[model samples]
Target: MQIVVFGLNHNTAPVEIRERLFFAESQAPHLLKTLRDRGIRESAVLSTCNRTEVYFCTDNADSSLAAIKEVLEKHFDVDRRILEGYTYTFRDESSYKHLFLVASGLDSMVVGEPQILGQVKDAYRMAVHSNTTGYLLNKLFHKTFNVAKRVRSETRIGYNPVSISSMAIELSKRIFGELHNRKVLVIGAGEMSETALKHLKKEGLSNIFIINRTFGNAKKLAEDIAGIPYPFESMSDLLGQVDMVLASTGAEKPLIEAGLVLQIMKRRKNRPLFIVDIAMPRDVDPSVNNIENVYLYDIDDLKDLSQKHLSDRLKESELALGIIDGEVAAFSSWLRQSEKNPLIAYVIDKAEAIRVKEFRKASQKLKNADEETIRNIEALTKAIVNKLVHPHVTLIKQDSDREISETIKRLFTPDEEDEKDLDNRNEGQ
Candidate 1:
């Protein structure tokens, strides 16, 4: 069997496409079982906010992918065409490399983000509990996790603010010099908002307010993070109360418009406000960036900070790649060595059984001979057979180390039909 990965991610597909194909954490066990029943020997599904990937071990990769696609379509009730364009498939060595990159966080939108490592481990554990894991996948994922750990420890890949939330906080610091004593208003109690709040809290910013459409969620997050919670209806009024505003609400259009900000600024006599908009399609207005004394930074503006961090961590990334390469080579060698064991054993066992049978037949034919003579004859026959087969047997035993073991096995162990054809041709000749 070979390793195969089929999936799409933030780099290849938009969130809308990814969300449609995403397998929830609760659905993984059933999905893994379904894939195993469909002839995928081993399988795992990794569905994060930015990507959805399916890894499997199968001889027929095409059939496996087809089965997966059919399952996804049926489960999500989506048109296959919607995902077909964004989906990518990798097999064998490429699949192995891709998984390593994913675990290493090199494949993330924010290169070197450490969360993917834990996410990957969680997926692997889910697969293990579901009984969808086998030798190949277990070995591959274990190695991948180790590689990620080594990368994180040895490399500076995860040392920077590459995540959207962290980057927003970084931008806020750059504008205001420090986050302490600044009133930061976090709009929406979503995962992104929570992450942003965490980063803000870490920077010694104690003044925080969380506002969500659902009051309970806002209250929950506020209580958990020791921040104040406000109702969504009070967002506009709270806009003028904070120095830094990070908004990631799920509104369709711009929630904080240039006109709204202008009105708010009038109330505060044009005091400087740093606005970090982390939402897609954006919660804050794009034109607000042109407003004087109101610094508005969106996701694109955060790239500069991420790039600088990436440059600083480049050496560590190289070291991580070296580790992954070494692990890949070792795993490949072990797999190749494993393939030769059964073939070599079969050949040696068959040859020994034939030699024993021949020697017994020769001894039965010498019943009239003296006992000493008969024993001498048997000894001589055994010695001759050993001498004749020693070189071949030694070679077969050492086949695990030889590069040409597969070729040698194919030459000696032709299928039964082929061996019969050879015998018939010899007889005709």
Candidate 2:
């Protein structure tokens, strides 16, 4: 099977296109099931504000790619031409390498942003829970999580708060000179809101008003962060009181329209109101920027700031790329070896089975053993199994002689009957 990824990202598409393709958490399972029904197995979808990507294992790359496009066209009602024009495809090494960069935050809009790692983990978990991921995808995602963790530990790329929230805060600081004693209204109780609120709190903002579509959610988040929570209906009333507004909600339509902002501006007597709409669909309307004394900055507005921040993270990014490259090489080698030799997998499985069987048998006899003793026994058995299987595995890899392969396969086979079964399977192959 070939490992492949095909989709559009922030670099390839604009916010409008990305939002159109964005898949919510609840929608991922349906997408995975659809791919499975279409014979594209072991699939996972990573849909964030910045990108929508599908990673899968398939025997025919062309057919699988077509199937994915068909799904997008049929399910999302997107134009096929748009997908063909905006999407990118990567195979084998390049495919997983892209995943590594994404999971490690190297591919984020704000490079070195830490939130993408959690988003990746959530995507993997959703796929696993949907039962769409098999051995290959399971291994790939686990390795991806490890790579992200390693990047965070080994490099300083994520040493500071270089996220969308931080960018908004920076822009706010530039406009206001200082956030101290400033009144800010945050519309959303999601991660983005929480992150931005934390930064604002550190900046000594005197009053932080948080509101959400769900009153309970906003109240809960306010309790957690020591902010004031008001009913969702009071958003407009709070708008006129705050000096700046940070909006990052999942509303389908613009929550703050140009007309509403116009009335709020009149209430503020033309006081300068900086509004940063960081949500995907954009919580604030674009025309709000045209309102006097009302400035609106949407998600796209952060691109230049993200680029400037990236320059400062270049060195750490290079180190993280070095780590990702090494991991890609290792994973690629393992994939190649396993794909080339089924007997190698069989041998390893057989050895593991033997080890487990022996360990269980010994465990029954060691009823009074301490936990440490039990762990040591398990490790000893595993080591013994590996040592016993090492030479045979090395031989099979070094020499691809069919007769030697058959001999080793037979030796590893459970018994005479299993050996016969192996022979039959080899013949069929």
Best TM-score goes to which candidate? 2
Compute the lDDT of residue 47 as modeled in candidate 2. Answer: 93
Pairs in steric clash, model 1 = none
Give one digit per residue, the lDDT tens place, for model 2 in 1-429. Answer: 789999889999999889889889999999999999998867999999998999998878899999999998988898888899988999999999999999999998878888899999999988866767765787799899999999999998986545567777777877888888999988988887887788778989999898998999999999988989998899889998999988888989989888888898899898889998889899888988898777788878786666656776887899999999999999999888687886876687667666767787899999999999998998799789879999998999899998999889878887888777656645644
Best by lDDT: 2
Residue 277 displacement in candidate 2 (angstroms): 17
Q: What is the C-alpha RMSD of each candidate to the true structure, in Å?
A: 16.9, 10.3
What are the clashing pairs of model 2?
none
lDDT of 1 by residue, 1-429 (tens): 678999999989998888888878999999889888887868999999989999998767788889999987887798888758898999887788889999999888777888899899999989976878765687789888887787788777888776667777766777888888889888877787787788788888868888988899989999989999988888878888888888888889988989999899988788889988878878998999878889988777776777778787775677778877887787777656634454443344344445556766777887788989977876787587568656665676665555565555456454887456434533533
Query: lDDT of each model, Cα atoms only?
Result: 0.79, 0.86
- Once superposed on the true structure, which residue ranges of model 1 sit more than 4 Å away at CA? 167-195, 198-226, 229-304, 314-319, 342-429
Model 2: worst 10 consecutive residues (lDDT sum): 420-429
TM-scores vs. true structure, each candidate: 0.56, 0.57
RMSD of 2: 10.3
lDDT of 1: 0.79
